[model samples]
Target: MMLPSKTVLVFSLFLLLNGILPSTTVAAARTTIGFTYSAVPSNSPSPEHVVAALQSLNIPAVRLLNPSPTLIRAFSYSNISLLLTVPNHLVTSFADNRSSATLWLYNNVLPFHPRARISLISVGADVITAAGDSGSDPTTAIVTAMQNLHHALIDLGIRTVSVSTTFSFINVITTAFPPSSAEFQEPVNSLVIKPVLEFLEETNSSLLMNVYPYNVYKLHGEIPISFALFEEGPFNFRDDVVTGVRYHNLFDMMVDSVIAAMAVSGYENVPLILTETGWPSNDEHMNVEESKMYAERYLQGLISHLKSGLGTPLRKEGAAETYIYQLFDDENESNSRRNNSLISDGDTMQQHWGVMYNNLTMKYNIHFDNADQISTVLGLLVPSMYFLWLLYDFRLAGILLVLVYFHSRKSEGLDTKITFITCQIFTSRFISGLLIDIDDYFCAFGAAKTHVSRSAFLVSTMLIFSVA
Candidate 1:
C-alpha cells in the first residue's frame, strides 16, 4: 500500500522534526571564550607564573604574542588553550618558500601540540600598520605565508589548528561614525586587505583586531568619556540621518565599524574577535581611578553584550568573542609613549589592573564560574531554539497552504474568487520563473546539477501555467 503525497509530506516533516531539529539543537549548545596575553614578554615573567595566575582566575584560553619556549613549557601541563603568533619580520621569509613554513611549524608548534594546547596560530601581527612604518604593506606576503603555514599544519596531522593574521589601528574603517557607514580605506582595501580577507575566509580563521575605545575617546574628546566607558549616562548625541542609533558607547560603534568594513569587502560572515581591549590605570592622559572605573565598566558592558547573544547593530547574529588586552602590566615596554598601551604610571595603579599583580595578589575578584554557567546555558538554549523555530516555520507553512486551499474551494463559484485565484496562481508562476532564472545563473557559476534540476522543475511549473 502506497501513502498519499500529503501523508508522505507529513511523514517527511515528522522525520525532519525528530532527526534534523534535535541534532541542530544539540550542535548549537556550545560557547567559546578566549583571552590574549601579550603582556607576558619573553623574559619579563615566568610562563609558569602566568599559567598559575590564569589557572587561579579560571581562564580557559589565551592568545600569545609569540610562541616562546618558556610560554609553551609553562602551559604544557595546563588545560589552558593557546593561540600563538608569527611575528611580522618572519613573514617575508616564510613567503619565500612554503617548505620553510613547514620547518618553522616543526620547531615552534608541532612538538607541543597536545601538551601546550596550541589551538590556533596567527601568521603575523597587524598587516595594516601605520603607513611609512617599516615594511608596512606586508599584507600579500603575510597572507601567502599564512596559507602556506595552514597547509603545513594540516599536512602534519594537526586537525584543530587554524592560520590567520591580526590587524591594528590603521585597519579601522574610514567613516566609522553612525556605525552603519563604516568601510576600509581604498588604498588598504586594494593593497593589504582583499587578499587577506580571502585567505581568512578560506582558512576559517577569526579576524583578530586590537580594539581600544579609550583611544577613540582620547583622540576625539568631543565624545563623552562616559559613553566610551559604557557608563549608564545619556547619549552625547543622536544621529539625524539614522534615527534611534544614539552615540552611547564607543565599543559598539567601533565593532559596527568593523562589521561595515566586512560588508563592503564582501566577507561579512567572517568572525571578528577582540584580540585586545583594556584601559591603563595610571596614564598621564586619564585619571587613575577613572581609568580603573572605565576598565571595569567596559569589561562588564562587553560581557553583558556577549551574554545577550545578539550581534552588533549591523551584524546581529555574528560572533561576539572578545579577549581583554593584558593579564598584567609589563615593565619592559614604554607604555607612556604609545597611547594604546596602558601602564600604571605609578606602582599602586599598575597593581590595580592585574587580576593577580606582581606580588601574586588577586585584585577585583569576579566569579567566572557563574559567568561560565550562564554561557553554557545559552550555548544549549540558542541552538535548541533555532532548530525549534525551523520546525515551527515548516509546520506553519503547511497549515497556511491547507487553509488557502479550503478558502479557494469555498469561493470557487464567485467571480471575485475566480479573479483572485487567477491572480494568486499568476503571481506564483512569476515568482517561480524568477527563482528558476536565479537557479540557472547559479548553475552557470558552477552550482551542482542537483540544485539546478530543482530550478528546472520550477521552470517547468511556470511553463505549464503559461500554457494553461
Candidate 2:
C-alpha cells in the first residue's frame, strides 16, 4: 500500500530533522573513556607491550596506579594522556615536607613529562582508607600534599600537570538513595573535601573519584540490579522526590550525589574525573553478581551512555574523563594491595577487576573507541540521503544527463553547450518540482487553496510542460 505523498514527505522531514539536530545542536565535549593500569612488579607485562595494546585499542588516556619511571617513559610520544597517581602511604610524608613532593616528581615526572603527556597527578587514592589502616587521620594531609605538589610543579616550571586526590564514592557520600539529598560525610567534608575542592578550583583541576555502581547495588539491595547495570526500560527509573528529577541509571545518581555534595560545599563548578570505575569479572567466592556476563554488560552500557554526550542529570558535561578499573588482573599481588583503597560496605573480598589477563589478552570483547558516534552519524545520514533521493527522484536527473551526453556526442564541438543545456534543464525541473510540491502540500491542508503565487505556478507549469 502506497502512503500519501504528504505523509511520505512528513516522515522524510522527521527523519532528516531527527538525524541532523542531534549531531549539530548538542555541542558538549565528548567524555573521554580510559583504562587504569596497575603494575605488579613480578607478573605484569612490559610497559612497551601495554602501550602497544592501548594504542591498538585506541585508548586516549590511562591512569597509572603505581607509576614507575619506566612505565611513564614508555608512554612518551604515544600521544596518550597519563593520569599518574601517588601511593596513599606517602600522602602524609609529602604533606609534611615540600622537598618530598619535589623529589617524588623528580623521580616520576620530570624526565618524561610533555613527551609522556602527563595530564593529571593524583596525589593519593582513597587516603581515608589508608589513614584508617595506618591508625591516624591523614585525610587533611591530602590537601596539604596536593598543595605541595602543585607548588613543586610550579617551581619546576611544569604547569600542565594538575594535582588532586582520588576519593571513593562509598567512603564520601552520606546518602545515595536520593542523589539530591546526598552530602559529603562529616569531618572529612569540612576538613578534607572542602579544602581539597578549593585547591582544585584554584588550580583548575578536577575532583577525582572512584565510583562503582556494584558497590552501591551491594550496599542498597532495594535498588534494582538493572539500574546499576545501565539497562534502559520504561520502569528502570527512580524519582528524586525532593528535586523532582528522575534518574535512569544508578551511576548517574552516584555521580550527581557527588555533584550535589560539591554544590553544597560551594564548588559546584569544579570539574569531575572518575579515576576508577568497573565491575569485577569474577570473585573468590564465585558470587552470582560477580560474573563475566554482568561485567561485560555493565562496562558496555557505561561506555555507550558516556559516549552519548548526555552527561549526568546534574552536570551536563559529566565526568571530564572516566578510567575503567584495572587493565590486567594482578594475581601475584597480595589481597591487601589488590583491594587496597576500594573497601566499601564492609565487603573486602578479593575480586578480579582486570579487563585483561596477565597474558595481555582481553577477557571481554569491547571496543574502547566511540564508534557509536560514527555509527549515529552514518545511521542518520544514510536514511536522510535515501529520503532526499526519494523526494527529488534524482534517477530521472541522472538519466537525463546520460541522454544529453549521448545525443550531444553525435554533434562534434557541442559537448560544453550540451552540458550547459542539461544543467539548465535539471535546474528548471528542480525549481518547478519544488514550487509545485509546496503548492500541493499547502493545497492538501487548505482544500485547494494554493500557497505559491498564481504567477509563480504558471511559470513553473509552463517550464514543466515545455520540458515534457
Best by the lDDT measure: 2
On residues 14-89, what C-alpha lDDT tens digit does candidate 1 reach at each position?
A: 3443343222212111124555665544444666776887888777888887677656778887998788888767
- In order of listing, the candidates' clash counts read 2, 0
| C-alpha TM-scores of all predictions | 0.68, 0.74
> Candidate 1, which segments miss by more than 4 Å at Cα?
1-31, 39-45, 135-139, 236-248, 283-290, 318-320, 335-355, 365-468
lDDT of 2 at 155: 99
Candidate that scores best on TM-score = 2
How much is the lDDT of residue 459 in candidate 1? 68
Q: List the global CA lDDT of all models.
A: 0.62, 0.78
In candidate 2, which residue pairs get closer than 3 Å at backbone N, Cα or C atoms, i.e. clash? none
